[model samples]
Structure formats: structure tokens, C-alpha cells
Target chain A: MSTEIDKSKVVLYSYWRSSCSWRVRIALAYKKIKYEYHAIHLLKDGGQQKTDEYAHINPMKAIPALIIDGHIIGQSLAIMEYLEEYRPENPLLPKDLYARAIVRQMMQIIGSDIQPLQNLKVLQTVAEFTGQEEKKAEWAKRWIANGFNGLEKLLEKHSGQFCYGDQVSFADLCLPAQVYNANRFNVDMSHYPLIQKINKHLATIPEFIEALPSNQPDAEVQC
Target chain B: MSTEIDKSKVVLYSYWRSSCSWRVRIALAYKKIKYEYHAIHLLKDGGQQKTDEYAHINPMKAIPALIIDGHIIGQSLAIMEYLEEYRPENPLLPKDLYARAIVRQMMQIIGSDIQPLQNLKVLQTVAEFTGQEEKKAEWAKRWIANGFNGLEKLLEKHSGQFCYGDQVSFADLCLPAQVYNANRFNVDMSHYPLIQKINKHLATIPEFIEALPSNQPDAEVQC
Candidate 1:
């Protein structure tokens, strides 16, 4: 018999400071699309996203749910693809099918492999279970580094100013968000020169600058 | 400064019992795509996937790297999309723009949200950190139920014989693999009748049965 576990709490999440959220934001900025941003305080009021109000806006009860023309779309990658599908003005994926798969491969390294493991909730759960609350940062650092190691190898062949080519595509959008996350967790990037170099290069792009957590209206003031 | 963390072990994983691998397998089977299955043996010989041989094939060192015509594709969802793009025969996604986004959204609820948390490496890491090896099953169940809760609700509006309408889209391919995982973790499914119903129906199909973990060539002998 299975014990009743928590239901209705979904985390295909988009948080104010979440890397996944930044992934969508950067892509949107690259496309030069303007949209209003809402601050769903994840830590305040026991998470505004958990409320019944937010659930109606998004049955999944996740942050970063995009409301386009009264239709709501959840999941960061899905939103990215949707924008690519409908807008097609500023394409984010490569033209070749195989090349597109390559771009997505790198994005998933950050999206699925890294982001989920370092999620704030998952880290809290780990800390509680481990009885070492301070280890949350360590958990985030470890997972980020693991994914970056593979990513560094991946970019060796794919890089030329951006992931998979000179153009700003899906991989470029994902890398900055990951690097921002890696910096938050204080992941040492000396071992990953390519990643560090590419991230530094990306940070200079105006679109990337616009999407940084520090630039967001809802960003917390850090000392 | 971030402490030295484990690196280079990527999880473009395709282990015999892994949930993501099964998703791609079911989709591949559904398309009547015949391909060779190579068992990289995740646990044997100190993880064959970690070796230089496998890295050449996929530097990510993950399992189920699908090599077609000398072009290797990694990531389960990426592989599935690649199939849909290249094959276009027996489509797995809806034709409508918003509908495609919807299909991909559910896949992420499982792929990015659930599967990553319940990954064997992640679970093992949690067990090691928490020193509660037995609680691993509880952890797995908790995440599965959490994702399924939202998934069940999403299905109320979209489901027919499968996850979305009558046609087997990307969401249907991802559902059974997660359901198989839920069963192993003993997640309570009473609240998720739609999911339960869809999975029950999907299992009866020969393609899904052929892709089940127990039927894999590398599967260990059952008592």
C-alpha cells in the first residue's frame, strides 16, 4: 500500500531567481519580445504559487507560467519552443535537424540534469534528511559542477562565440542561466575555462544583461 | 570557493532500469522504429558508460545515446523530438501549435520535474547524505505523487484514450515510464484515476510491453 504523499504541488517551476525562469526570460529578450513580469514570492506567504488563485492561472501551480493571449503555457523549455513556433522572428534553434538536437542536448544538461537536482525545494529536502542544513549550498555546487564538466566537453566542439555556432540559439540561452546559478552556488569555474569564457562572453550581450536576476524587478536586495 | 565535487559523470542516462530510457524506448517502439539496443551496463564494470569508449560515442557518458546513421542524439525528450522531426511518420505530437506546447509541458512535469529527482544516482546520493537508505523509497514515492497530482489534473482537460486526445503524443510516451517508476516506489494512485486508467491502457499495447524494463535484454533474472 502506498502512503498518501503531497499532491497538487507541482514544480516545473519558474521562480524569481530560478535559473529555469531566467532561461525563458533570456530567450524572450533575445527575440526582442516585451512582456510584464510578476513577482510570485516563493518564500513569502508559504509560496504564492501554492495558493488556489495561482492554481487557476496554472493548474500545475508552478511559477513562470506564461499567459499568452489568455492561454497559459507552463514549463520553461515548452515556452521557449512555443515562442520559436509562433513567433519565428528570432529563431533560437538551429536550422538543421541534427544541429537542433545538439542544441537541445546541451540545454537538457542544464535544464533536466542540473536544474532539478539543485532546485531549492529538493535541496531543502536533502538538508532536512541529512540533518545538515548547511549542506544545501554544497549540494547545489556539486550538481552544477557535475553538469558543467560534461557541458565543457560538449562546448569544445560546438563553440565559436555561442553554443553550436556563432548565432544565439537555445544553448546560448541556457548557459548564462546556468552560469548565474553556478556563481550563486560558488562553483569554481577555473577548471571549466570554455564555460567560464563563454559565460563571460554571454554576460556582455544586452539581452543577457537584461535577464540577470539582479536586473529583475522582484530581485531581493543583497548586501 | 566551492569545494571539489564529483564531476564528469553525466546522466544522459539509459540504464536498463532507468525511467528516462524507458520513455524513449516506448516512443521508439511506438513509431515502429527498429534500432539496435546496446546495454552499457550502468552498474557492471564500474559503469561502462563512464569509460573512454562510451565518451567517444557520447561525452556526456550517459546511457541510451541513440546513434542513427552515425549521428548520435542524447537526452530522451531531445531524441523523441528528433524522431518526430526526421520520421514524421506515425506522429507522437499534436499538429496544432498550442497542442504541441501542451504535450511538451507534461513531458517536462515528468522529465525535468520528476525523473531528475528520482534518478538512481540522485536517490543514492540522498541515501548516502541522509544515512537513511530505507527512506529512498519514500523519497521516490513523494516526488512521483507530487508530479502525478498535477499531471492528473492537467489530463482532465486533454486526455482521451491517451495523455492527449486519441493519438499517442509525446506525453503518452513519457507517462508509462513514470508510472512504472511509481509502481516500484509504491506511490498511491487512487487519487489519480485518469493517470491510472491511461497507464493501464498503454500497458496493454504491445509496443509498451516490449519496452518495459522487465522485458529488456539486460534485465536481471526475476525470482
Candidate 2:
């Protein structure tokens, strides 16, 4: 039975080095899904993300909003989970409920607990609280170090080849992205040996390699 | 054929007025799952959650860690999603792909974007940046107001009786919890007509009412 093809392609509104967008890109590549990449520069021209045009796409005005069939979905975790539910192939989460919970737990540790504290917008607002212009990279490193300390301890037992076990899961997807940001902030990776180790291994995977910030169409030579 | 009753009991390590904990409570009540509640005070004796015992339970040392059959799961989003997957009944998330993505999106908006910025630990760390012990509730109100402004616009189109629609999903589970915190922070809910309306309505529901922080065993009479 020939079914209707989805002509409305998946368009990812992403910033080149965005950890969230990198996670989604890895998920898409792992699922072997095709997508059109739209680079929405996060820092150029007072952040293209803050423009009225992007706000119409995501009122949150965040990058990594996945547009499919004209329906836009924001939030990286949501976008990745949507792909899992929509395709259910090349599963990013484990089959067992308990195991999947652990994967989700690890992802949330980074996603909810860690990354939000280090977000671009959140960092941009840090000067208001500091009563002076704070170093953006310093703010990022502070939060990343704090969160990664907790994450490193959590990964002690659960981590095998990846965050959970032998197979790559959602935790693996989230780790690389956060690690990318960690490197950018000059966070001491030595403090998180396991995280650094797992991140090192994930870099070798084809999916992770393809989704690297340097591999993106919007990749820029950083000074 | 009669199904065997599961012998393993569910135990939740939670704190009263913890928005993340409240979210998991609502999901458990909505699922009608019998569970033991262990109150892990977030702000007592230098924060009980920072204790060694709680650290053993959840390495991340966060609240709302579900212990079932000797296995533990931390993070409210993970716990709620675990409930959805473990039982797959009384679904808090819609089964349809697009619908579920939006629910998760709204949940992430509240879970990742809003609440983390206002978390007890995050607020406690504000002194590091500000050089003075800041007003905790004031800080909470600031981030809540910023996030709600964006959320209000998103709800303008999607909201019906709930954040998504008439049917209560994970978005519904998340909204009430964050709204509960919003009240504590004295965030002006009047600015968010749709959010205020939905929150008021959610109060009438048994699940939400039962999950109220005031109804919990550890609830203290606020002076």
C-alpha cells in the first residue's frame, strides 16, 4: 500500500554551537532522518533568536525548534522525544522501563539541572545580579562546574560504554552537547573524568562526529 | 485471568512546596498509584536533602526520587515519564506524536526554562554573584515573571481548558506545580489570564487538590 509522503520537510532552526540544537541534530542523524538545517545565529545582530520572526515560530524565542509539517516544536528534549515516538526506530532510549528512566534521569540531570544555568540568555542576564558586568565565560564555567560535579558522581555507576550502558541513549545525546559547551567555557574536564571519558568516546561515533559544531553549515572560525 | 498484584511499593522522597516534587505527586495521584511519601526537607537542618542519607538515595541530592523495587529514579520529569511508560495507563501524555511533543514542550518550558532558575540551590548560590544575601522570593518572582511572560503568549493560542487543550496531559501536570510556586513568589498571575484561568480550574480537580503542598504530610502551617 503506497502511503502519502511527507513533503513538508523537517527544518531545524538552530545555532551552530548550541548544545540543544547539537543534541537534536545527533538524534536526527542517529535515526537516519533527513532534515533541512536553518542556521539562526544566536549572537549576531543582537541575537536573531530575539527577532519577531523567530518569536512567531517559538514564543520562547529559543533556537532548536523543530518545524515539521508546518508545526513547530521547541525544547530539545521534546524534539528528540518526538522523533522517538514518531519513528520508534534506532531507539535512543532503552527498551526496559527502569533502564529508560535512568537514561532520562541522566539527561534531566544535564538538561534540567545543568544546562539551564549555563544558557546564553541566562548568562546574558547575569550582569544585572552581579551589579557589574560579569565575564560571560566565567559565569558559564561556574555553573557548568557546579552541575558537572553532580553529574560526574551520578555517572560513576550507571555509565558503561555510554551514560547508561553499551547502547547509546538519550543521555548520550545530551552529554555531548553539554560537553561541547563545557569545552567552550574552559570548564576543568579533569574534575569530571568519567564525563570527559564518555564524551571522548562519543566523539568517535559517526552520528556524533557529523553533529559536531564545526560540521554545521553555520560553523564559524572562533578566535 | 486475574493479574498478580505487584508486591514492590513506590516511595517518593519529596518536600512540601517543592514544585518539582508537587509535579510528581500530581502524576502519581492522577495515575492512582499507591505510594509511600517520605518528606525530605529542602530547607531544614541546613537542608536535609544535602544529608548523606539522601545523597545515597539520589546521588544528585535532589528531591522527588522514586524508590521502587529497590531501584531509584531522580528528577521529576524522569519520574513522571517513568510512570507514563511503566504503567502506560491513564496517560499523562497524549499518544499522538505531534500532541505529545507539545505537551513535552510545555513541560520543558516549565521544568527546564522556568523552575531551575528559581530552584532553592540556584537561589542560594545567588550570593556568590551578588555579594549579598539576596531576597530569595524576589529572585524567584523575577525569573517566574520573565518565563511566564513568554509562556503567556504561547498559551494564548494553544490553551483551551488546559495548557494544551481540554484533556489533561503532562503539560497539565507541570502547569499546576509551577503555578503553585508562582503564588509563593507573589508573581502577578493577573498578567497571565490563560495561565491563571487554567490554574484556578486545575485546583478543582481531585488530583491537583490532593497534590497541593498544604495537603502533604510534611506541610507546615506557614506563619
Candidate 3:
């Protein structure tokens, strides 16, 4: 089933700390896909993502656009889906249709419902609107809590050792990055016992652990 | 390949003006899948979506949750994907994996990147942040324009009469609703020629026309 596309050209444009970027990294790791990594410092140089050179790669000015199978796929979900289709082994989706939909629903609880509102750009906008720097964290925490509240409820029906059943699905890829972001915003995880339980277990998985922001080449060494 | 679930149980919880709801509407119409439409007025009674009953249907508390095949699928993209997998006839996704990925990338440009940031709750939050009722449209327009700018670029490479080639993929389902929302916000579409062209073509589609917000059972019938 190999195509004419060269495998060596696969590259991932990513930022060390971006949640969306982390999701793709975990997907790549979990699938054991190989790729070259190019760090796009989202906060450095007025966002390297906003530059003309980067715009040629992704007009959305977003990170984690993967160049694979001779195509540039933007959006983490799109990229992950492409990978799932490109290499079907160690599938990120479940075998059953209902389970797959539930996994996607859990993923969107973070992807659509939560992450967009609390991203770096939106937080910066909130700060500008209120003229108060502290409002940034407050704003991020509110949306995180709001989405986690729904996510925990869904987890009650769907979660086992992971966000779905015992298998680590696409939803689990989203969990660690979001929980990391929530901790930064001082979101109390005690309210989301199911999420806390699953995230705790995910921390021990090599696929999740290897994709941690701290493990990335561009990660800033903390003081 | 028929399922045991009753087709009569297929239901869609939707709001007339909701962009995400409209996306699923178009998908269902395109596929000719029959379902019961239950309107959840997002603005009435402090949002019918906030009720505990609605939470059971979708803990994310969003509209366009489809109850089909004896399963409740939340998130427009998730539901749409479920639909694509559930009924392979008149598929919303392309057969080619690269084409499927491209369609998804175009869809996410609206789904993940644009729509979430400009939805009802986020707009209300924006108004509360600035204490100016006018900032709501301004905020919505900004994100819509930002996303459309990228989308138009992608369309240049992918579009023919529709968003990707002449065939209507899932990306086309997202177009009319977003264009309708953009028009409401007064986003100058002159900058996005490709989007404007594709949107114009999509209007002639029966599936799209039938799913227009104004065509729904609960439409407010604006003066």
C-alpha cells in the first residue's frame, strides 16, 4: 500500500508548549510514526507562526502543521486523522462506530469547547480588554472549569482507565495537555475526579510521557 | 448492514441560528437521513441548553446533538463523522485519504478555528468583558475574518465550484452557515473572494437551502 510519496519529507511544525501541538505529538508517538521536528516559537519574535515564511506552510498561522505523504495538513485533529488513515496500525479510534463517536466527543470537549477559549491569543485579548493582566488566568480558568465540568460528566459514562474504555484513544491524547494547561491556570482538578484519575494513569504511559512539553527540544529550561 | 436501532428514535437537538447546528442540518439533508428536529432556543429562558435535561443529552451543553442509531452523539464534527460512517451512501467525505484530509482541514478552518470563538456564549462573555453591547459583533467579526482569511487561501488551491473540486464534501456543509454568520457580523467578504464564490454556489444546493437558519421550524421570522 506504499505510495509514491517519500517518507523522509514528513515534518511537524510545532511549539513546545502548545496544547494542540502536544496532541499531535502524542498521536505520532503512539502510532510510532517518524518525522522531522521544526520548532515554531509561538511567543517568540511576535509569534513565528505569524511570519510570511510560516504563512506559506499554514495560512492559519497555527502550529503543528504536518507535511506528510506529500501534503501539508493543518489543524491538529485533521493531522491526527490523516495519520490514523495514513497508518492504520495502533489505531487512535475505536473499532465500534458508537465508541469512535464518543471518543471524538470527549476529544472535542477539550478541542472545541475548552481549548479555543483559553489559548494564548485569547488570553492576551482578555488582558487587553480588561487592562488587567490577572484577568488572563481568570478567563482561562473559567472556560477550563466550564468544559471540564462537562467532560467529567461524559467521562462518568465513557471512561475506564482512559477517557473511553481501557484503551488509550484520541481523547486521552487531549487529556494530558489540557490538564497541564489547567494546572497553569490554577484550575482545581479535585472537581473532576474522573479526569484526574485518567490523567494520572496517562502520565505513566510512554507515548504520553515522551510527548510532554518539558521533553521537547525547544522547551524553556525553568529557573 | 442495517442496525437494530429504530429510525424513529433519530432526533436532532438544534437551534435555528446556531452555525454548528446548521452544519449538521446540511449534512443530514445532503445524506437524506430522516430525523426529528427539536429546537433548543439558545437565547430563551437563559438558554434551554443550560437545563439539567439538556446536559444529559450533551454535557457540553451545545446544540446540534444528534440522537441516532440508539446513541447520542455530541459535537457537530463528531456527529457528522458518525453520520458519514453510519450511512456510507452519498458520502460527505471523499474516498481518497488525501482528499478526505483536505476536506477536513477546510472544515476545521470553520469548525475548530472560527465557529467556536464566535458562538453565542463567547460573544456574551465578550460583551460582559467590555460592558459594551457593541463589542459582541466586533469580536465575532474579528475571529471570523481571521479564520476566513486562512480558509480563502486554502480554497485557492482546493476549490472548483465547491470548496474542494466540484463535489460537495463536509467542508461545503460548513460554508453557508459561516457565510450567513459572517454576513450578520458585517465582515467585508470582499477580501475572501474564494469563500464568497463557493458560498454563492452552495446556495443553489437543495440540501443547503433546506438547512438555512431561516428555513428551520423555530426561526424567529425576522422583520
Candidate 4:
């Protein structure tokens, strides 16, 4: 069933290097939803997210906000689930409720567990508290290791060709961006073969490749 | 339709003072699902969550794990969503997709934004880094204030009687538990009248009232 909402008018407020933004971008691509990418430099002039224009789009002053037919949706996980609901032709979730729960669990591991610990503000706090740049990196590495260890164990039980199974759900969309961030911080994925394997497979997907931070035009100029 | 699964056979591995566990407790009460609560002392014996048995239940070594028909589900948000799926009669999400997205966003704000910052590990890290109890509390207060400010703004727009209008969603299950933790740390809620109001409303509810940390069987007994 086609949604009554107009498809051509959809726009995504995103930052090139934000993993959360990349999750939504991958979801849009997977669902074949055509959307205009409106880049918002998160670090420019004390962050464009705090600006009036962006705040009007998302009161929370966060990235990965979706504007569909004038209605705004914030939060990357929420946006991906919304896309799955509106555009069900190319489904992102599994048919069974149990399977869907497993997929959502995977999303939560990244969305809730990993991403928040390494967020910009948390990094800043780590720097302030420790008064050492190396200590901040260590803090980031610690949380990443903790989250990835749990993820690796969970993936051991359920992973097939992807994080959930053979099909690519929202979990697949999350893994690449997180793996990319981890790589930047020099996280040792060699201990997590399943994660490394999934990352390798996701890298070959056109949707994942196109959504890479380096692929964005604004990423070239580095704000 | 009554699920074939027996509610009485359910067992919840929880910690009385843990906000995450309290979230699951509220969900169980809301659904009227019968279950035995097995308390895990988060602080005692150097965190009982790291014990062999608890690790078997949840490799993540987190509290608020639900064991149903021999299968285990971890993460408070995921557990509540799973409950809503199986016990759809007491729905925690709205019928409309947009409405559901709003509910999920509220959950995200608590699950991702607020809860993690003040969690045990983060708090301990702050104390370790600062080498002062007062400074750690200050760190806690700062993040909580930032999160609550954003939450209050979002609540102003969406709240009616609860976090997302009249009917309680998964968001309600999360907010009270989190707010309770913030209150324990003496983070004043005077600024967020909407949150304070909702906190009062939630407190009066039988399910929420019964799920309080003070009301737990393990409350008086030191871990």
C-alpha cells in the first residue's frame, strides 16, 4: 500500500562523519527512498545543530533528522523504523516477531550501547576530567571494547551472513558506521571475526559504500 | 489471543536499585505478567552481575534480564518492546506509525541520552578520574541537567498526562526509573515542571509505585 504522503519532498538533515546520520542514510538507500541530503556541519562555529534553522527542524539539536512532507522525525533509530513502516516494499525488519526482536536488539547494542559512550560530549568530558588527550582515547577504547565484546558474543548465537541473519536489517546499517568509527580509533576487530566478516561484506554493498564519510562532498573540505 | 507461553514460569534477573531493572519491573506489572524476581546485587561482592550464573543469562553482564520459556532477553528497552509484542492487549505503542515513532523517540532520549551518562560504570569512572566524590557528583549533575533540559523541551511538545500523551507507552516505563535514579543523586527537577508533574503522576500508578526500589524485597537487606 502506497502512503498518501508525497515522496519527492523528503529531506535528511545529516552530518558527513556522524555514525547516527549514516544509519539513516543507509536505511533510506535500502528502502529506495529518494531524499535530498542537507548537510549540517556539527563542528563548524560551535556546531550548526545549535543554529535556529536546525533547531526548528529538531528541537533536540541533533543530527539525522528526516523531513517527510513537512513532518520532521529525529533520532536515527526512530527514523529507520519510520522508513520501514512507510516504505514496506523493501522490508528492513523480519516477518516474525521474535526475529524482529533480535534485529531490534542488534540496533540497540549500537544505538544505545556503543554510540553514546563515544559521543562528542562524552569525549569532551573525558578530556576535561583526565586533562589528557591520550586518556580520552583510552576512555573511548574501553567503552568500544566493552560494547564490541558483548556484540561479538550475541552475534555468535544469531549471525548467519549478517549481524542478525542472512538478510540485511537495520543492524547491518549500524555495524558499518560503528566499525568505521572503531577503525578510526584503532579498535582491534581482529578479535571479532564475525564483526570483521560482516564489516567486510557490508563494505561491498553499494548503499554502505556510498554512505561512507569520505564519499560525502562536504567531507572533502572537512568543514 | 492468549499466548501459549506461561507467565508464571518467567524469571527476571534484576537489581533493585538499578534503573534498567526497574524499567523491566514496571513492564511486568503493567502487563500483569507473573514472574519471580531474582535480585542481583550490583555492588555486593564486587558486582554480582559478573558472576558465572549471571554471565550465563546475559553475557553483557547487565541487570534486568528476562528469562522466558528458557530464552533470555537483555536490555530494558528491548525487553519492554518484546513484552509489548507478545502481550499486545496492553499496547505500549500507538497504532499509527508516526505516533509509534514519537513514543520510540522518548524512549531513545532516556535510554540513550540520560541513563548511560549516570550509569554505574560512568559514575565510577568519573570518581576514579577526578579523585573526589564531590567532583564526580558535579559531573553527574552536569550531564543530567543537559539531558533533562532537552527532555523537558521535548516533553512540553508531546506530553499530555504522560511522556507521550494520555496512554502510557514504553517511554513511561523508562522515564520514571531514570528520574528515580536522578533524584537519588539529588538532581533537582524543579526546572522541568512537566517532568516533575509526570513523575508525580507515575508515582501514584500502582504498577509504578510497586516497582520502586524501596519496595523491592531486597531493599532492606544489604547485598
Candidate 5:
């Protein structure tokens, strides 16, 4: 089950503020896997991700594509799993099978159920459909609040210091970016205290801090 | 790494037409794992999944929750991974690590990207936001088409007889349900020949046929 890694040539195509890309960055930092960063501007030049070359690298035309083990891996969750399997050191998953499943369940509550509804392209589509730009944030806020309601309840049973009993699992990797997006959308965090507590605790961790969207190379350069 | 399964008590909370639930059903059938089916009717009596008892079982209040190995595992991908790990006999993932990542990449294209955008709750929100019931189908079709465009390209490089090589991996588990959904939304399948081909091939497999929406116990039951 072990795969050899040629770490020198590892590359990550990422955007500064993409919640999905931020998840991968957290995993890479937590696992201490060094990679070349290629910024794909989601807002500049009519969305650089839509370029044919980027599309060739990642058919999904999505951020957080990883070039590792001589293959192009797309999808943040997929990339994180590859990183976990590729470098099992500093493991991002639990050793117990059920705990691992729980961690994944928590991860998907954010990744699949929440983030996709609020990501840039989907938000853009929402704007187009509604013909009201302000509706985008309103749309994002409602879905994030909906997902966080369930997540906060789940966390009440699962949280110790992290999303899954004190371990900085993949679910933790998802939490900060989502909270960041939530704040941007003006989601009322008063209702989800557990999520806020976990997000605040994760802030003090070096790996999580280092992967912050504000710290990425492409964070504030004018588009 | 193996967790003992109490095959007798295995329970699945599912809705017949849910694409996510169908995924777990397919994996269970493929691996010959028997489970008790508890129908969570998504449209009857104000959605059985929203009941307090079901919410307690799955905090996310989502369908396709598996009660196995003394744990209530939520999320279809997580349940499938548990199935793969709990009983590794007819593995749903490829042996090679990189190939496994590719398989997962393919799965998330459908799971995270496509399915979520068009799932019942999201579509319901779409209808509410636009104040037009007809917008639901249009929204679903657009997102499905957007994802299928990328998926068809990925399949071109990866497909042999299924979504990833000749094997019936988890990606293959995801295809039929999505194509079923796409067809439900009246998406033009001519643009995604690879998806159509894989969907066609999956139909011949007994495991897939047995898990089809029409075969589920609750499929045609009246409200």
C-alpha cells in the first residue's frame, strides 16, 4: 500500500482564497510535504482556470490539483487522501476504522454539503440565475447556516479540542476555510459555538495558520 | 485494520431515488453485504429524514446512513470506504495508490461537484429563491452539464470498461445514479459519450441492476 514519492517535482495548482484549495494547503503543511505552488487566478483574465492548458492539467478546471506520483490528481478531498496515503507520517486520519469514517462524515458535511453551494463558480451561477449580485452572499449564508446547524449538533457529541475528538483530522482541515467563508457571507456564528471554538483552536496551530488564505502567494496581488 | 461487522444488525437509512443512497446500495450489493433497509421517505409526511429520531441517528439529517460495526456512519462515500475497509474482499478501489486516487477523483466529481448542486434540498432552495418551480430543473441541468463536461474528458483518459479502467471501482458505483439523475433532468447525454458508455456498461452488472431505484422496496410506494 506504500507509494514512492518524488517530492522534488510535486506541484500544486491553487488559488489564494479557494476554500477547497485551502484544504489541500492545510494537508500539505500538516504532512510537511513540500510542493511547487502554481497560482491559478480564479478572478483574473476571465478566470484563468477556464484556460485550455489548466483544463488539460485538471479537466474539472478546479483549484487544488496536485501533481504527485506521476499523476495529476484533482479534487481537494482526493488530493488530501493521496497525500495521506502517499505520506502516512503525521497521519490526517484516525487509526480506528469507525473513527476514520466519522472524520470523513464530518469532512463531507463541510466539503460536499456546504462548500459546493458557496464556491465561486456556483456563486457566479447563482448570480446569473437570479440576476441579483447581492443574492450571492444571501445564498451562501443560508446554505452555510443550514450545514453548520447540523455540524454544530454533531460536534456537540464529537468534539474534544477538534472536530473529531482532539485529532486534527481532514475535517479540521475543512473547518477554518469554511468558517472564513461563513464570516465572509455574514453567517451568524453565534448559533454554532462548537464550530467557532474549534475554528479558534485551529488558528493557534502552525500548520493551519501557515495555510491561511491571506498567507498564500496570490492572496492580495491586484487582479 | 479490519473491523468486525455484525452483518445481522447492519442497517441503512435510505430513500430509493436518492443518488447518494443508491451509491451505498450498489457497494453493499457488489460486496455481498446484507443490511436492513429502513426507508426514509424524503417526500412523504414532510420528509421522514427530517424527523427528530432520524436527526439523532444522523446529525446531518441526511439519507444513506449506515448502522454498522456499532456505529451510525453518515455520508455515502464514507460508508463505501467503510465497506471497502471492513470487508476488503471484492475491493472497490484499485490496488495502485495513484489509481486509487484517480478513482476517488472521479467519485468526487460526481459526489461533491455534481450531486450536491442538484440534490433535493438544494433544488428546493433554488425553487424557493427564484419563486419559480421550473427553475429547479434548469439549475440541475446546468450543474450536471458543467460537471459532465469535465468527467467525459477524464473518462477518455481513464476508462476501459468502466469509469476507471476495466474494474468496477467506486467511480463506477457513482456513474449510473448520476446518469439516472441527469436523464431525470433531461440533460442531453449525446455530449457525454464516455459517461453514457460507462452507464450502459454498468447496467449489465447484476450488483448495479439490483440497486436501481425501481428495485428498492420504497421505490413506488404511494405517499
Candidate 6:
């Protein structure tokens, strides 16, 4: 089932501020895969994703696309899971079926629940269509709180130092990227100590640090 | 890993019009898993999910909850995958890894991309907080089309009789449930012949037919 892929041959179409992109960046770093980054400015010129060049690559007009051996994979969770399956050395999911289900469930809380509500297009459309900038923040805050609360409760039962036991699974990669966006939008997090503690621990990991928005070349211009 | 349980023991907390519930229903019927239908009207009493009992069953206050062995699992995709894993006699995923990934990506297009944009909560919040029903529909239409277009392209490469090479996989369960909702909102399907062909094929399948909103006990009162 394995194909020999040159480590340097892989390329990621990413945006530094895109939380979806951050998920893949962390997964690649954790898997210790060497790849080149092709930064796509999601906000530029009504989104570079809509351009003829990028449309040929991804019709969905979304960031965080992975190009491996001339095959393009979209969807952050799918891409991350693909990497885990191909590069099983440093596993992102546990070997046990129940444990894998738990980890995948936690990832779903972020992927399906939190991130979609607060995606850049959704928020931008919220403002454009309604002219309610404050309510946009309110929308993001409400859903983030809703998702994080459920996650906090789930983690309380299983937390050692991360979202699922002690391992830095895909859940760990997803949570910090989402929480970081939530913080930037002024979503309060003082109540969940476990979430705060896990984020603190995640901050210390070099893979996470390297994938931070601040570490990307495009971060300065956007900020 | 197989556990025997009484046919009458299965319980589903579902809403008649919910696309999520429809997905689970199809999965359960496809696997021949008999279950009791427990209708929790999403709109009644400002949503029955907010009630103490329902909330206890699903902390997320979402629909399509599967109660098996007295344990609850929410989120339609998660519940469907769990059923597929537990009841492998009728597999919903392909035996090969690449085929499985393709099925998963198709499911992701619905679960993560299309359905999230048009979710009840998202539309309700947009209407209540932003007073932009028209714009919300536009947003929904855009994402749905985006997802379907990518799916259509993928199907070009992958389809034989379904979204992933003939056999009924999780994608079959997902696409019809989503496209049904999209069409209810007048999302034109004229362009996506592949999707249309598949959905037409799926509608005749007894499992999907049984799960239709019109067939549910609570459909008349709710819709």
C-alpha cells in the first residue's frame, strides 16, 4: 500500500491565518514530512482561490490543499488522516479502535462544529450581508463557546496533558488553531483550565511553534 | 467485538425533517439494525433538545442520536461510521484504503462543507441576529454548489454506480440526505447529472425510502 514519495516533492497550498491550513501544517510537522509551502493569500483580490490558476487546483476555493505525487487532496481532516495512514511511524491516532474513534470524535468537534461557523468567508459574509460587525463576533463567540464547552467536558474525562490522553493526536492540532482564532475574536476562555493547560503544553511543542501564524512569512503583512 | 442486542432495544432520537437524522436512518436500515423511533421535535418548545432529558441524551443538543447498549452517540457522520464499524457484515466503506479515503472525502463534502452552511442553527442565528434570510440562502447556495461541483468532478474519476465505485458506501447515505435539503430550498440540481442519477438510484432503495421525511411518523405535524 506504500508508494515511495520523495520527502521534498510534496507541496502544501496554505494560508498562514487559515486555521484549516494550520491543522495540516502541524500534522506534516508531527509526521516529520519535509515539504515546501506555497502560500495562498485567501483575502487577496476577492480571494486568490477564485482565480483561474487556483481554481484549476481546487474548485472548492479553499485553503489547506495538499499535493502529494501530483494528486491533490482537500479537506483538512481528510488530508490529515491521509498523512496518518501513509506515514504511520509517528501515529496521529491510537491503534485501538475505541481510542481512534474518540480522537476522531474530538477532531470532529473542531472540524465540523467550531471552525465552520467562524470561517473567514462565513464571517465576512455575515458582515457584508447584514452590516452587523458586532453580531459577527457574537456568532463566532457563541459557537466557539458551545463547541469548547463540550470539548472541555469530554477532555475532563480523558485529559492527562492533551485533548486525548497524553498523545498529541490530530485533536491537539485542531484545538489550538481554533482556540487561537477564538481568542483573536475575543471569545473568553478563563473558565476552562484544562483547555488552557493543554494549549500551554501545545505551545511548547516545536512542531506547533513552527506552524504558528506568526512563524509564517505572510503573517506580518496580514497583521 | 460483536454484541447481541434485542431488535426493540435500539432507539433513535430524531427529527422528521433533519438531514442528519435521515443519514443515520439510512445507515441503520442498510445494515438491517432495527430501532425504535423516538421523535424529539427540533422546533417544539423552542427545541426539545434544550429539555433536561434530551440534553442529557445529547449534550450538544443535536439530532440523529443513536442509543445503543444504553450509550448515546451524536453527530450523524460519527454515528453512521460507528454503525458501519460495529456491523461490518454489510460494509459501507470500501476494502481498499484509497477507496475508503475517496468515500470519506465525499462524506466530508456533505458533513463538513455543504450541510454545515445550511444547518438549522446557522440559518436561525443568521435570521434572528442579522435579519438577512436572503443572504443566508445565498451563502448556503454558494457552498452547496461549491461542494457538489467538486463532488461531481471527483465522481467523474471514481463513480461506477455510486459516489465511490458501485457498492453503497457512506457517501450514498450522505449525498441524498444533503441534496434533499438543498432541493427543498430550491437549489437547482440541473447541472449535477451524476449526483442526480445517484440520488434517483438511492431513492428507490428501501432503506433510503423508509427514511424519507414524508414517511416519518412526526412528518405531518412538523412540516
A87-184 in candidate 2: lDDT tens per residue? 88899999998899999998998899889888877777676667666566777887788778777877897889898888999999999878878888
Docking class of 5: medium
TM-score of chain B of each: 0.89, 0.90, 0.94, 0.92, 0.94, 0.92
Question: lDDT by residue for model 6 over A193-218, one digit each (tens)?
Answer: 88899999999999999889888867
Q: Higher-DockQ candidate among 2 and 4?
A: 2
Report interface Cα RMSD per prediction: 1.0, 1.4, 0.9, 1.4, 0.8, 2.0
Encode model 4's per-residue lDDT on A1-223: one tens digit a residue.
1224334588888889898998888888888878788888888889888876666667678888898855778888888888898889778888877777777877888888789888887898888877876777777777788888888988999899888889899888899878877887888889889999989998999988888877776685532
Candidate 5 clash pair list: none
**Which should have the higher TM-score, number 1 or number 4?**
4
**Candidate 1 wrongly placed segments (more than 4 Å):** A1-15, B1-14
Where does candidate 1 chain A have its weakest 10-residue lDDT segment?
A1-10
User: What lDDT would candidate 2 get against the real structure?
Assistant: 0.84
lDDT tens digits by residue: candidate 1, A151-194: 88888978878888788888888887677778888999898998
Q: Model 6: clashing residue pairs?
A: none
What does candidate 6's lDDT look like per residue over B18-49, in tens digits?
98899889898888988889898888889887
Q: Pick the candidate with the highest TM-score.
A: 3
Error of 4 at A148 (Å): 0.7
TM-score of 6: 0.90
Best by lDDT: 5
Query: TM-score of the candidate numbered 5?
Result: 0.95
CA lDDT scores, all candidates in order: 0.80, 0.84, 0.88, 0.81, 0.89, 0.80
State the lDDT of candidate 5 residue by residue for A92-169, as single tens digits: 999999889988998999989999999988998888888889989999999899899988988998889999997789
**How many clashes in each candidate?**
2, 0, 0, 0, 0, 0
* Model with the higher DockQ, candidate 2 or 3: 3
* Over 4 Å off, model 2: A1-7, A134-138, B1-8, B134-138
Docking class of 1: medium
